[model samples]
Target: MERQLIAALAALALVAGCASPQPAPVQLVDQQQYTKAMRDNSSTFTWPESRKPDLAVLAEKSGPGRDRAPSGSERIVLEITNSCACYLGWEDARKRGDQAAASQALKVMDEVLPKFSPEDPDGQRYARETAAKAKAGDGSQAADYVANNCDSVLWK
Candidate 1:
């Protein structure tokens, strides 16, 4: 009986150890209430209600020399990440040769490239050349193109 009891306790210990832990409870706050709280607080800056999502509020708050030209670096980074994801997906679409998937990825890159800023002459030229190369089936040129020109023109 003692042995059976010991075995049962051991089994209970094992079962307890195997159980998954519970997640913490999340607290949800409404936007207006949060905004009101922020406004009421002396430490925080109160934002106007008319401020939209796309407004450069953070940049504005950064003060002088913050309102520079809109560079496409962020867009370029997003595009490059998307392109890499598409390329990996395309690779899995066929056994030996998936020309269709490759073509689809190329089309996506082409569509996204034109949306980049042409304000920076060097970046613009590099972007155009890279897009042309990509269209011509030399997609590998993109990494080199980005590395050479993206930091100089896209980023601040």
Candidate 2:
């Protein structure tokens, strides 16, 4: 009975370690500003309320109230620690001459990339930087780079 209990606990630990990581929860910095950023403003698409959490990794600038751009508008900012493994998986497939898998990965990236709305200047800048990183390599560390070395999506 003691051996069986120990084995069960070990199995539980293994399962726990295998569980997928959850995205960090996003917080609203300013309700009105967040609302303003969600509207159609200087972009092809209007920011949606549902996709706010998708905004993460970087902001347009530092200092107080950096999340807001255009004075009164705000974008969602989540701690960009987590990464999507799709980019690495895509790399593996291309390396193995697996065109079908590579194509599938491209599709996922397409779906994922547009989540970075270009409406906010910070979002546009982040999107551009992320695209550049995607072309460079596995692209997993792109957000880490932005968070560490860059500001939110501000214009030139």
lDDT of all predictions: 0.38, 0.39
Query: Could you give candidate 1's per-residue lDDT for residues 33-72 as a string of tens digits?
Result: 3233322331222111221112132222211221221122
TM-score of each: 0.34, 0.29
Q: 26-107 in candidate 2: lDDT tens per residue?
A: 3223424533343323233222222222332222222123232222222222212111234444555667888887666555
71 Cα displacement, candidate 2 (Å): 25
**Each candidate: how many clashes?**
0, 5
At residue 130, candidate 1 shows an lDDT of: 59
| Residue 6 lDDT, candidate 2, scale 0-100 | 27
Number of the top lDDT candidate: 2
Q: lDDT of model 1 at residue 56?
A: 30
lDDT of 1 at 143: 59
- State the TM-score for model 2: 0.29
